[model samples]
Target: MEAAFRYREREGDLKAPYEHTEGPYPLGRWLSEQRRTFRAGQMDGERAAELEGLGIVWDTADAAFETNLAAARAYYRLHGTLAAPRGAAILDVQVGQWLTNVRRPGGLGQDPVRAERRAAALAAVDPDWNPAVLGWTVDWQRHYAYLAQLLDEGARLRAVTAGVTRHGEDIGRWLVTQRRDWARLNPEQQARLTALGVTPARVVRARQAPAKKRSTTTSGRGAAAFEAGVQALAQYLAREGGGTPGRSHVERLPDGSEHRTGVWLANQRQRRDRLDTGQLEALAGLGVPWAAS
Candidate 1:
């Protein structure tokens, strides 16, 4: 008991290393034996009370989990989310690897009650700490959190250009990809992004006016025309699957508007060399696989 008291006073916790000794006494091994005895309900009531009074933790694993949970909270406070990569750590705790382990099926130990408490604690730290969705990964969630932070800071979505990055992730490029693959996102994911002022790209033509600034007007018109072409291609794919259309083919959309989709597609292919990476990616995501090449 004297040796245990000395170790506890020095370490600030009862979690001593297995090889730890207090002077000539193997205090760590003795403490482990006490925990075993306590678990088996074989420890004397008086002795158990003494150890408990000294703040002895009978469950070393639980103590370790609490330590790691502190690290996770610190990480979240710093990064705004618990979507840590595989090697992320806080001080001495391998928080990222710990999160991965606990997120696994049946990884929270066999005690149902303890698991529930641990899960609740983690959720309190960050609700999406362990994403429950099938396709949601830590990397995706991390980027999303970063985007959310930028939005909260009043950053405009359109102004986040390809080079605008946060924590090594090109959020602007990611935003573009999300807009391009809007149809591929699950409803919940779409709803989340929509709530954050993100939406699928659409063609918005400027009102016709006198040629006061033809250069700026022409640039705007060109972008609107390209978006219109992309919209047509998307509609054509929805109706006709992946088959390429003939040059004379025309598609009548739900809005009762006719698009010369075949000609538009051919023109886009001809001008593929001029398309930006985002534009090409948008086309590729819409099933125009050749755009990727």
Candidate 2:
């Protein structure tokens, strides 16, 4: 297990909290002593910090991350497949592995967003092929789809179940994410799936559904007022805070009217969480920066 995996440093400097802990905060200048401290993404921050600031000097963060990956890699090695059992609730396991960026020394790491892709690829392959490489087009995280090298079209599969799985919301649902993918299915197949409330159109709508409605605080507003409120929030973000307001951060002006920008900025500073890509893009469209804290 140790031979197949080793810790690799993703970066040189450590980030905040663990960035410069002098055995404590503020006077953490002693962090430089561990020059090779492995950079751990925000997976298990407290443990990562302890590993770096306490014992395990060199490659501390990477060691912690790699050690965890060893277990998952063992499963993959034994199965020659990364697929979990039919009822193992596979996505949950994938989420845990991805949180720490687990990977082989030079191999691609797990990504939560791409769980579906990996799952689909695994579904595309035949159970007979184990540990086969160089098949699918899943880029680096190729956990499945490795097949025989023979050049025979007779062994090919016709539109196997790549996206659809017997899972929640997706249970009996087609894997066709976009409406166009429906072309792969014949009219009989389409009708059979639709009868079970699992059609390509339904899948697209489910995936594109908007988030749950806002809290009761804003539930009274009509559609027109909702648009106005969003526009006002955007303009305020552009003018005052320079960033978008989050659920926690928000404030009221001197006149007593709640100002979304002011409060969002305040809360953002109080809780130093990073904004995701989608959030940053939305703020960019409004001429506001993505600065959270």
Scored by lDDT, model 1 comes in at: 0.76
Off by over 4 Å in 1: 1-48, 51-56, 203-293
Clash pairs of candidate 2?
22-28, 249-263, 249-264, 250-263, 250-264, 251-263
Per-model tally of clashing residue pairs: 0, 6
Task: Point to the candidate with the largest TM-score.
Answer: 1
Per-residue lDDT tens digits for candidate 2, residues 1-293, read 11111111322334322222232243222332333343434336565565544334454444333333333444445434443232221212442234222121112324543443333333343232111122111111122112111112233322324542221223112233313345443454456445433446534344566655432322344433333434455444322323345655444433455545545544434432343333433433444443412
TM-score of each: 0.54, 0.22
Question: Cα lDDT of all candidates, in order?
Answer: 0.76, 0.34
In terms of TM-score, how similar is model 2 to the real structure? 0.22
